[model samples]
Target: MQISDLPYTDPGVPDARSGPRFLWWLGRNQAGGQLKSLAWGLLHFGGVMALPYGVGFAVQAVVDRSGGRLAFAGLLLVLAGVCLAFGDTMLHRTAVTNWITAAARVQQLLARRTAHLGSALTRRVAAGEVVAVSTGDVEKIGWFVEAVSRFTAAAVTVAAVCVALLIHQPDLGLVVALGVPLVALGVLPLLPRATRLADVQREKAGKATELASDTVAGLRVLRGIGGEELFLDRYRRASQDVRHAAVRSARMWSAISALQVLLPGALLIVVVWHGLGLVRDGRIEVGELVTVYSAVMLLTYPLRHFEEIAMAYSFSRPSAKRAARVLSLERTTTGGPDAGPVADPAGGADDPRTPPSGDLFDPVTGLLAPEGRLTAVVCGDPDEAGRLAERLGGHAALDEGDVPGPSVRLGEAPLDALPLDAARAVVLVQDKDPVLLSGTLSELLDVPASGNVTVDDALTAAECGDVLDALAQASVDEDPMAAPITERGRSLSGGQRQRLALARSLVTDPEVLVLDEPTSAVDSHTEARIADGLRTVRKGRTTVVCTSSPLLLDRAERVVFVHEGEVAAVGVHRVLVRTDPRYRAVVTRETEEEQRRSGSTANSTDAASPNGSGPVIEIEETA
Candidate 1:
């Protein structure tokens, strides 16, 4: 596969039985590239091996004083030089292509797997591990794959050189031939130890990477809580552990390198010593001695590949294993025995049978959401609220055996029973902390534009007009919506980022919108505006918003109070606030927090505007 043919529409299914098996799978996928690499490798190594014979024949011609033989020897030398130059150049080109193509294929597979698993991928694998596998691990795997053909060609060339040596001088050739295997296999005893060190180093490195990733992602939170030093120290220790492991791993490989050099030196000495004896006994001519000696020296170069292949395998084995583990993750949700494929929802939300626009039921929490109504779910335990929201979207957490439990049904059909795309289309779950990708504002809010909602409509409903104004202020020349956003919208305030994410989800206009605290980051006034806009935009559609804010709850048509992971009460927000003490306490606490924030804001505004010309928004309980 070439780089031009990359980003495959469908990266084929991978073999995930084991690391070696996965490597073999990659090789199989790029069989043509591998063959080209192999052919180039043969040409390169063949030319290298011919150098010794060219020198030997040239020496023989000089001794015989035959001009014809000398000319033939010169031609042979010229031919070897041409092969060397051409073969080496092409070998490098093909080798790099093989590496790039292999790495690209693995990266594509990873990206495909990541898309298939969606949010579950991060939940199952560490963010750093995924990053590591896609970047560093992929390159390592490709290196081993690209190295294999060269190693094979080297072995073949070495064997052929030994055969030629034996034909020229049996005594010295036998000594050199026996030493060749010894040099190649001498490192076998140390391989297991080396592999163990490499594994340990990789494991520690992954942990360090994970720690660093988490630290960076949560740096803002850490600073807010004055825990930056604590996390910094933790990362420091993790990085140190990685360093120590790498050093230990290096030591073992260093020993292997020492043996590589030492054993070859010993073998060279033995070959020379034996060849001299053969020359003294007149069993081998001086020219034969020189040829055998040259062949042995040339063989050393190919013998180094044995050690290189071993090291590459040791490092790549673990990397491929990690990649395979990630690739092995399957879509747990499948249709039931009696279930059939759900029809595509692309046409419109006209079909009542499509779950997203249908009534929603969460059997786990015993919460029922009526179709075409705005429902609010409030739970004292934020964890329970989060879990319930996920379950409501049919995200059944995998059990110990990696199997999904019962699924929530939409429109009388289990959501898990629907095709993954169909299920996602029907129910869109917006997490409490939604991610805002780095792109222009347009790209950030670009979803499958449902004809029901336009970009401007969704952004206005999300109460993000001020956000656009702020972005416009930052860049006067460019359109605010066309301006670039930093990763995760870090450049924007928390409230601004949150509203943008909501706008993206709003544009989709799924049948059932499951939002976990959509307006939590915004102020009371903004939240009220958002709540009213959301209610208006989502009229006659199933909307489940997990929130406790009085402003948002008061706007909901129905409110479900969940306690201890079960629905405790179901009524309008006013009725629940008056009757349920637990519900009242949660809302009351949030009200107190909002009041304190408003007072702080008012004090700051008073100081900044001594003339009191600027307007100040006050917090209030809309309910």
Candidate 2:
């Protein structure tokens, strides 16, 4: 089956049984390949048993010296060698093929599940755990799956060899046959303990991986705040813990290995001792005794597989559990009756083409962002506004049981009811500091849209004309319009990065553009130009700017003041700033003194210096 056909339906809440079920489901999907691999394994291992029996016949013929049969015995020995050589080669080939196919299937299923989960995956599972599952867990699962057929074939071969020995010489055969199984089964009691140790080792490794990922992602901020050493120390501690867990797991595996070796050696010794006695008593022919010895020696090959199967299970079980946890995460489902196709506010749903509604409303916050208008949200705390923007964009889950205040309706249809692709098509949330991936300027602005907004137009709209001039003056080989932007635009100044991100967002020309503090980094001159340019460029499209910037606020048609996360006042920016204390407090930095005192003393001292340089600088004046 194609990767696209794999089921991504949420299996509901995961339990202990989920891991095994996931493996069983994978096996069922690839049953045809699995069966073929099994058949090949049996053919290969069956060949292994025949070689030893032929060797015994050759030895018996040599001992008898009867009627030129010695020549036939030599032929039997040569045939036995050929069968073994061919069987070993074919076994390796089939097993490797099975391993690769199983790994590919699991990888595809994971990719499909990840796409379905989207952002919800980060919320449910640590980023490190996801990485581990995709790479290491997939390998472990493939190892276990591929081992299954070989394990079965090995068991069968062992039984067949034992039966062959019993028919040739019952006295020695019984002891050899019985002892091999006892040696192989002896490892079973240690498996549970070994598995537990392995689980602990895996958990510790996952935690260390998480700590490292977090440290790397935040390394810049950590260094800026002089917390790099602190985080480094913590990571080192986590690494040490992982090492300890790994050592413990290794110790358990070592004990199991020792037992596997000891039991097999003892069984071999017993078979040899008993067979020699039977040879001396004249109760068994020399050729028959040779056959019994050959069968006993062949038993070791299958017995080794038993130990390997145990090892595979010990590693794979936890990996499967991790994969199942990721697969079980459920995406938020809008429970309302299907509202049918969404109508465009500008035209009818039956129309072939129309711009979808740009309205965004939050039931929890009672915030209404109307369609085809410029709106500004002024929040007392910038962090709160940023979080609210994520909720409004449907990137996060809202608290249940709260009144469904104002569903973000596209005409009569709720935004929540729309598919992710459809919703993204209508509303785009551009962060104050949106990430700019490494690419040429042209590539960065390459968004999904019909019209071509020249690089000059986007730059003008974001007031990035100066940034273009700077790049030109630098004499960079790349064109200003085609200049490469580094990852997160780190090469550019804060203002340049902010404008470039805004330019990129504008290039999309989304129906509803929700930007958080888009102009906070730019100078007043650039901010004013951006505000004015935005008004003209997005005149007919809906735009929501979450900023306390007076320059941006003046350009907005309506400004909503958010107090304690709820809308306290809504009107023209100047009107609310004049009448409302909450609006005045937010836009005018009324709490600057209180905020300074609460900040770190060292940073406060730097801010109060006569030179006007500080680690914790405030941009409240811009607002």
Candidate 3:
């Protein structure tokens, strides 16, 4: 691939069975580029080998005292110099291009996988590990891939030099040739141990990175609780552990590097010693001795590449493994809904077996949300409610082939059986603590234009005018939409952030909106306004809100009380409270909390609304 064709249009499905296999896959993807690199490397190293031959010719010409031969040798040396310069330059160019292109391809693959899996990717892998795999690990894998061609060229050059030396003098060439293998193979025993140490260092480094990421994410909370020092100490210990591991790994590699130099140096001495003895016995000429010595001296350069390739393979193997593990994750369901309507067996255009249109049904919890109505679910256990919410989004199962027991059905069709995009488009589940990416308010609200709702309408429906006003207070420009938001919206108050998230979701206007305590961070008054506005704005659409707020429940057309992972009762807020004692207790607890906040009498409030909604207090409060 050319440098301009960076970021491969299609990275294709990766082979994730093992690290070596994945690396092989990468090599195969860019076989042409690799071949080009190898060709350039051969030319470059060939040029280097020719310099020793030129020196041998020059010495012979000087010994014969022939001006013509000396001039010829001089011309040959000049030509070899030009080849050396050109070949080395092109070799580096091709090698670097290979590295960058390989890295870009892997990055594109990672990005595609990340987008396809969405939040599910993080559920299986740590955020830090994902970051490391995409960044540092990708670069290391590319490094190894780029080094392969150079290593091949070095091996070929070593063989060619051995042949040339042998052609000159058999006995001297045999000694030099035998020493070549010793220089390359002597350090094999140290590789396994070095690889192990490197793995340990990488593992410890990943943990430290994860710790730092989470700590940075929660820095505000840490400072609020005066636990910054405790976490700092923990991070300090983690960093020190990484340091120790890295040092140990470096020491092992250092020993290997020393051997690489020492063994080759020893061989250099032996070649020179043996070449001198050959001269004394008249077995080889002085010019031939110089050529053999120069050839071995230059051989040191390529032999070192053996060590480099080994080190690259050792470091890159585990990195590829980590990247493969992340890429292997798949969504719970695979197939999307078939295009067009269901067809009848009689070959008619309309299918009688079409799914029925009605309430959203969950066989697991035996809960039903009436079509085109606002429904609130009050679960004593928040965890159970969250799980149910996930089921609504067809994410309860762990794999596509795994039977989704007691699956959720929308319009009579099993939700898990529908196309993933179709199901997600129909149902948008907003979590309790929604994340707000770093961007302007307008950018935050900029989702695909699938629904009719606009940013202004959603903000109004979510009652976020106050939130916009609060954010505007800090901006130089008065327009809140133009103001910048920090990562995760950390600069905003919890309630402000929650309102902004709610606004962003409302803009989507999906057919089925499942909100898991969207307004939990806001006060009762703001939540009351949001509840009323949410119902009005979402008219004629299915909305399932998982919450226990008496105000929100009162606003809902129907409320389902979930107990012990099952729907215990379903009715209006007032009727269920009077009929089901468990439901009454849940609403009553929220009522008392409201009463305490407002400093009002419980009996008076109970008599005022008999609906269990407590008093309608609309006092404006800053988030």
Best by TM-score: 1
The TM-score measured for candidate 1 stands at 0.86
Query: Would you list the C-alpha lDDT of every candidate in the order shown?
Result: 0.81, 0.73, 0.81
Models, CA RMSD each: 9.1, 7.8, 7.4
Kindly indicate the candidate among 1 and 2 with the higher TM-score: 1
Tell me the spans in candidate 1 whose CA falls farther than 4 Å from its real position.
348-357, 379-384, 394-401, 454-457, 477-479, 548-551, 561-569, 572-623
Tens-digit lDDT string for candidate 2 (210-315):
8998897677668779999999999999999989998998998899889888898888788778878888998887777667777667667778899898898778
Q: Model 1, 370-487: lDDT tens per residue?
A: 9999999888888777777776766443522475656787766788777677777878888888888898887887778567988888999999999998888776575898778999
What would the TM-score be for candidate 3 when compared with the true structure? 0.85
Question: Model 1: which residue pairs collide?
Answer: 356-426, 356-511, 356-512, 357-511
RMSD of 2: 7.8
Model 2, stretches more than 4 Å misplaced?
1-17, 66-77, 113-120, 166-169, 335-337, 342-355, 377-391, 394-408, 431-435, 463-476, 485-498, 516-536, 545-556, 559-623
lDDT of prediction 3: 0.81
Give all TM-scores, in the order shown.
0.86, 0.79, 0.85
Q: Name every residue pair that clashes in candidate 2.
A: none
CA shift at 221, candidate 2, in angstroms?
Answer: 3.4
